[model samples]
Target: MQRVMAMRLRLLQRPVRIVAQSNAAFSTKAPEFSDIVYGQDTGVRTVQFNRPEKLNALTLPMAMHLTQRLHKIEANKTVNAVVFSGNGGKAFCAGGDIRALADNGKDPATRHGEDYVADVPKSQALKGQGLGTYLALTGERLKGHEVIGLGLATHYLPTSEYETLVHYLTGLEFADHVPQEQRDEMIHEALEELETDEAFQEIDPEYLETVESVFGALNDNDTMEGIFERLEKLNTEWSQETLATLKKMSPLSLKVTLEQMRQGAVKTCAECFQMEYRMATRMMENPDFFEGVRSVVVDKDRNPKWSKRDITKVTAKEVEAFFKPLDKDQELILYPSATAVTEKEE
Candidate 1:
């Protein structure tokens, strides 16, 4: 525990800058970091991550620094907006370079040992689009026509028109002379004009069939082991690759993700975020997230010795515990303010 706290302190020390709302309103001083730069416009603050050689891979300190800068921005009333950018031309981010462990740890629910999960799908379904929610929660990425078909994207403009769209948005940003509704119309029209018929093309029947057979089966899986066994029976290249991917992930994370996806399908967007916050808190307490980061990203070993190596060893009770309600005071309250729950539900 001392080691964890020491490592955390080491990571919190870094160089970062923020456009102060005012000099008098802040008490915290900027840390000494060379990899980040901050700039300001009339009412905009620009934060540029400056690790071009490392593809702007965010160190733990950088994350802590960015959090501080964000807090300062939040306290200031004068700052109109903030923009994040990367200094490199190659990649925007290479992900975080994390250490072995960062936070708390816990054992399984009731069993006191991580129980190998074997559970059944709930017979009842939600009022919302559960499959869509499940696909997102399980992180089943959709590309090209798949994205449009899954309602994941509203606009599918061509590569050629990207620059044009950016320019139009930038010009409109400075053109406050335009009314808000007119501005909205102009943006919508610009995207529509740049769109291609490629987006409207019918999804392949074979693709739908595969999705039904694969993802559909996954949805009905009782446990991670069941999912793997189901995949192994398919004995195809895609199934093999999929198993490899899942194995690379933290076992505990997989369990949490499974439970969250099932819950989020019927949940409000705010409710989903709240549920995720609980899951994230529990994951931090699980150590597997940090271990996953160390083995997969920082160490490059690609071998994470999870606390529980086997999915069948994971319990349905254990998975559900991660989503249990936190103490009342710690709960996320999205409906407290006027703009609360403002974003559209996915």
Candidate 2:
């Protein structure tokens, strides 16, 4: 319990803000048909991923469409809970389609055609709606009832009862700008009748203890090398499997991920994104990015010939270079100010 909660808390504290606002900005009103589809059920808007054939893998256009719908929903005062589901129940989203990313070759710098929306105003930050559940899907990805143990999902309703639950929730007839407490109580009552009292199958109390025991982010000093060393010391099946998985990933990416986690821990959502944008634009231009996408996606081969195959091959300065701010004109425009967040060099 301690470890899972700790992991979730850490993730919540440092929300990942990688998605940048497209320059063209999506019109809230989407085309009549597209990869992303929308439906209305009472006050609830169901945003269903229509690419079931691709296991709901997101293309760039699909991502842009979904982003626009979300912005429109967030701004709509009449809207209630937004239900996100896959058109085919197999998977919500298998993840992004990186094959297209390889085609991107060098398009990131001018990847500024779409628009993005903002969140609740700063004044409403303290008294905002209570139903905005931030689901924590980390590491290998927790699924189904496992999310409840980590406080990721508010309720655990089975698929059998999903239709009825959605109907009941949407039937809720609250007016615009309802009080936070009242709105929460209404949802609590609706879910109480349907939420299955199913015990978590995978993430038991011991699971959290296991996560805490792992030499990862929970331990402040755990670098990529240190983590591998600690896992070796543990000598458990989990550690061995994790080691294998980490070994397959590009060394430079692993280092950058770890460092960014440390930096993002103290930065605001917007700040974190500004940092990621700089890193992303730079990464797209790197040879490693092309090699990775080619081997993993285009060629369908598991063998990725990374320039820096091992940690010894990647230097601190190389990782540090990714955190530097982009030019003011190229920076992510979250606010009117164009100042970028710079990493403090060691």
Candidate 3:
């Protein structure tokens, strides 16, 4: 009994090492990292957005840092899984840094006439055509349950369970280090466990029904004007609230967003990205976006006096102008050959 107790004490005194030497393969430092915090324990690497005050809103530098880290992790044979999180408990990420964007447009060096257009619609279209448009236009946030129902998130855990879930997931042994045939069997077992998790099984049906209605409204072949007309007829309180919310958004933005979604329906993912690039370039020239950001993000005033007050006032020609391609130098180059760079020797 004395020998066993001494052995147990020695084990307890030793440092807790979850990862083997093979797993500590990547360099921990990044050349420029301010907006995010990165850490690795065992096989789980965590990339957490660090700006709590701003809800971890994305900036170009922050995005580049994340991309670089992901590439490094991919190359490391040690890492089994990654966890993306926010430093602040309030939000994982609130999306892009609209304030920085507004500032860039104000800077003489960066300001092109087209830099005045809002790019929210472009982002939303990629997420889920019409739904993305609606959320972007209205700046409506989704609750945890709503997010799960929309399939944006695979599982929803209450705040109480967040820490526990993190502990459990990080403790899981990666099948990668195991033999290939056993790896498949291990994955099957993990998936089977996930199938029985209460959070996965308990999606809110009411939220899903609401999502379906909103999607149907946004995807209808009619123009933004016609879609609103139908939405106005629905007698439900939710419909009334949605219309009221829509009324407060920039008229030009709503129309442009609706058009973008309609066009996105038939386009492939790559094609949609191309269309978005065109819209983004054109939006920089529009003044409504500047005013919208000034009111909402800069000034903290909810009221924005848009360039166009009513949706009916926004002409088809004005909407079509956003789709026109920029000059070759200004157009977005989507090819990997143009953007790819070899990693520097450490």
> Positional deviation of 293 in candidate 3, in angstroms?
1.2
Candidate with better lDDT, 2 vs 3: 3
Error of 1 at 135 (Å): 5.6
lDDT of 2: 0.60
TM-score of each: 0.61, 0.73, 0.76
Please list the C-alpha lDDT of all candidates, in the order they appear. Answer: 0.55, 0.60, 0.64
Q: Summarize candidate 1's per-residue lDDT along 1-346 as a digit string, tens digits.
A: 3433442343234221222244353222242577777764433455778889778877656776675666676555444445566776676665543331232132333211111111112211222233443353344655566677766677786555544444333322323344546545544554565667787877777756654565452456645566677668888887787777777666766766656655665676666667766765566667677677667667879778898876767887888888898777556554344432222211
* Regions of model 3 farther than 4 Å from truth: 1-32, 111-137, 173-221, 337-346
What are the runs in model 2 whose C-alpha is more than 4 Å off? Answer: 1-31, 107-139, 174-180, 199-202, 217-221, 336-346
- Writing each residue's lDDT as its tens digit, candidate 2 over 145-219 gives 776765657777678877665655555656455675766766665565565557345566664555555533556
Model 1, clash count? Answer: 8
Poorest 10 consecutive residues by lDDT, candidate 2: 128-137
Residue 333 error for model 3, in Å?
1.3
What does candidate 3's lDDT look like per residue over 98-128, in tens digits?
A: 7877788666567543343323334544454
- What is the lDDT ranking, best to worst? 3, 2, 1
Cα displacement (Å) at residue 18, model 3: 6.9
Q: Candidate 1: where are CA atoms >4 Å away?
A: 1-87, 90-140, 157-161, 173-179, 196-203, 217-222, 333-346
Higher-ranked by TM-score: 1 or 3: 3
